[model samples]
Target: DFFIEFSRQGPCILSRSILQLLYLPLFNKVFGTLNFADVLKDAAKNFIFPPVLMPKSTLLLNPQAKEYVDTFLTHCVRPFGNLVQLCGHNRARQRDKLAHLLEDFATLQDEGEWKTIEEKPPPSSPGRDSNLDLPVLSSLAQHDKRVSQLRHGGGGLDVDSYHRTGEAQCQRAERVDAYLHNLSLKSDSPRPHLACFGTWILYHTLRVMIMYLLSGFELELYSNHEYHYIFWYLYEFLYGWLVSALSRADSFLTEQEAMAEIHKGRGTKKNKSKKKKTRPYGREITIYQALQNICGGFYKVHIM
Candidate 1:
């Protein structure tokens, strides 16, 4: 609301206004990409005492001249900052508290601080009756591992232009593959390995997305111009997303490659005798096999 109000008054006015607003929040508070907190503080201040815009010459002559002017029509860009106000302050406050707790939890996990707790050692004496039921235990363990890593290895995008070169993308792909290798080992179920390479027709979608992000990253932007929204914010997001995806692909492919050798016949099923064919259908091949076939055929992109 605050930013949009500035927009209606034209470029020079909006730029000067925000530049001045940025100068006001001098280290007493931290600002974010959205700067929601600062914007809200500014709005409440304006509501109590609205802001007025003055011409450059007028401001030089009397800096306080606009302060005396009625602010009835000078509330430029005051409403856009209410982006998430539908949720009352009470709910927002609770969310903030919960967020802090989650941050602490994540920090602990990242640092493996939980391992610091001393656990009571198991008795060395053998039990009168001992049973080793491994199948069920192993299955459960696998399920828990997969569930935990469901959202793992993903991170915020790398927006540093220095990180966007072709060589960098390749390196990112390698790191992603390394992480995936670890994920696959935890599973080693033979299912994910197959699934990752087995799907067909995904490249059609992935190629388009990759190109869109690539183009957005290359687009030129003008300072204080209209391109900031598209170029800086959206493009940065897409680039990050692209980097994340490349890593995932690298991991999946790496696992698929290892599994390809293990399950020499990745996976396949024959059609009925009447419709029997020497070659396997797309669905019949393992995921890795499908990916290999598709990439080679469409883009001639080979996956090692």
Candidate 2:
């Protein structure tokens, strides 16, 4: 809110406005795009503290400019730094917690593959009890545990945790979609532009996935044989999803632009020519595509 108020004061506060310049790069760093101008429009169009644009010449410099800068750093920059540290801690915690479930899941898959290839049932563990009934009872209890975990949204195997996380993610996305729809209907705001905020959320989710994958390399975590599936996970999951999200957002923005032109009565040949020159999110989408290609290439090389 302080930044919003400061931004409305004037573009020039002796020099370039500190908050405006900071917001551009900070938003870009967080969202992976510099197309946050649409969000700025929400303040104006929604009448939520609409910026009263003052001419630079008449603007009086704030006497507490130094204090504002220090406050901004304390409030904004410090929290961001804390967020980065929290992410790192979460990554380490996930690795520690999920490592065993991942190994167990992989072992189960390998056993299934062996059973198929050999045309026989899988062998029991080498250190198993001689009593067959104990094994069966143990398996049944384990199965019950897994079922209970699934029902209660508790952690079981790595795969079950993933499923629950995915479900929660979907639910959150649905809530956001509903919120944006309601917002547009109530306020008569541009929905697609506001929906860019949803895309920004997707971008942060994608970034977290990327960080999780990269941390594997930084810690020399995966083994030589595991590298194949690790790269496969990166290719199939993270980058591919990123490209899809970015493409969808870009299309939404383009449609929003087109509809806006139509509303403004700019459907002339000259306007069309100008529109042809503009490419919404062109650079960001291109970068995502390139990363997807690189991940695909790495995956192919690993598999081969």
Candidate 3:
């Protein structure tokens, strides 16, 4: 009960109080005396004669449940997802536990007792063949949402959707390669419109980031319910992804130092001894603790 109460009220009270800590100079700087006795007296009085709850705020507890709620996200991630990323070149270092698990499952699925073969369409009906090509997600609401978002949104991601039989890691890499081949053309023709990247590696890096958002983010946090604004801001997530994407682009193009030109203007010189230019942000940093502050504490405190 205490834990529940703490989860409810802690966030509402702490959010406002934490902001006050930033402005503490307002009260302390002007005053000369640090009256320890008076501070203790006031605290006792307030506890005995507690005021009415504020419009949307509740009274926080002394033995506050802050710490428990604060760490709930870490708890959720261990069993479900640890926010790992997918890297094609360095598989072991980059892949998280969840990624490995899914890939393993995909592998077992290929060697399964039950086989689900896609049905062929009637030769007379061309439309039936096209319908077979249409993407189908599980009945789970989350999958439905991701598919809808992917269809409307960009960067070629349908996160919750399953892959064909293989290692999930290899499948992801294949998709990234396919995306570059189709989208990252050098010159624009009267052909279909595609999103092009400066270098082939840059496109792969972007795909990694997108895959992280799709897979890693899903692993860490649950989005089955309503709004998730408190957990992760869409703009911030994409913005951070872009930053990491560019960093990877710089490393791949400059350090690898291949003579092959990425574009007419872009340089592709080799550097035999290129130093690590900058510290690269890991996939976990951008998404970790995104929901820690808000998830469990959403209903911790109650109005009394």
Best by lDDT: 2
Instruction: For candidate 3, give the lDDT.
Output: 0.28
Comparison by lDDT, 2 against 3, better one: 2
lDDT of 2 by residue, 1-304 (tens): 3432343243454333343345444542424353333343342223211111112311113334323222322323232332332322334553443323332322222211111111122222222111111111112113433431211123312334333433333443343334334444444332422333334334434554455456577667656655544455456555666666666555655665565567677555554345344555578778877877787787678667
lDDT of 1 by residue, 1-304 (tens): 3332443244464454454456333322224344444453353322221111111222213333323122211221221222122112232242333323332222212211111112232222111121211121111112222221111133112222212232222332233223332344554241232112111111212222333322333432122222222232222332333333333444444444444445564466533454332322223234434443443343221111
Report RMSD for candidate 2.
Answer: 16.5
Best by TM-score: 2
**Weakest 10 consecutive residues, lDDT, candidate 2?**
110-119
TM-score-superior candidate, 2 or 3? 2
How well does each candidate superpose onto the true structure, as a TM-score?
0.20, 0.47, 0.19
Candidate 3 lDDT, 77-155, residue by residue in tens: 2212212111111222333432333333322222211111121221111111111111211211123233413221232
The TM-score ranking, best first, is 2, 1, 3
Clashing pairs in 3: 7-300, 8-299, 8-300, 8-301, 9-300, 9-301, 257-270
For candidate 3, report its TM-score: 0.19
lDDT of 2: 0.39
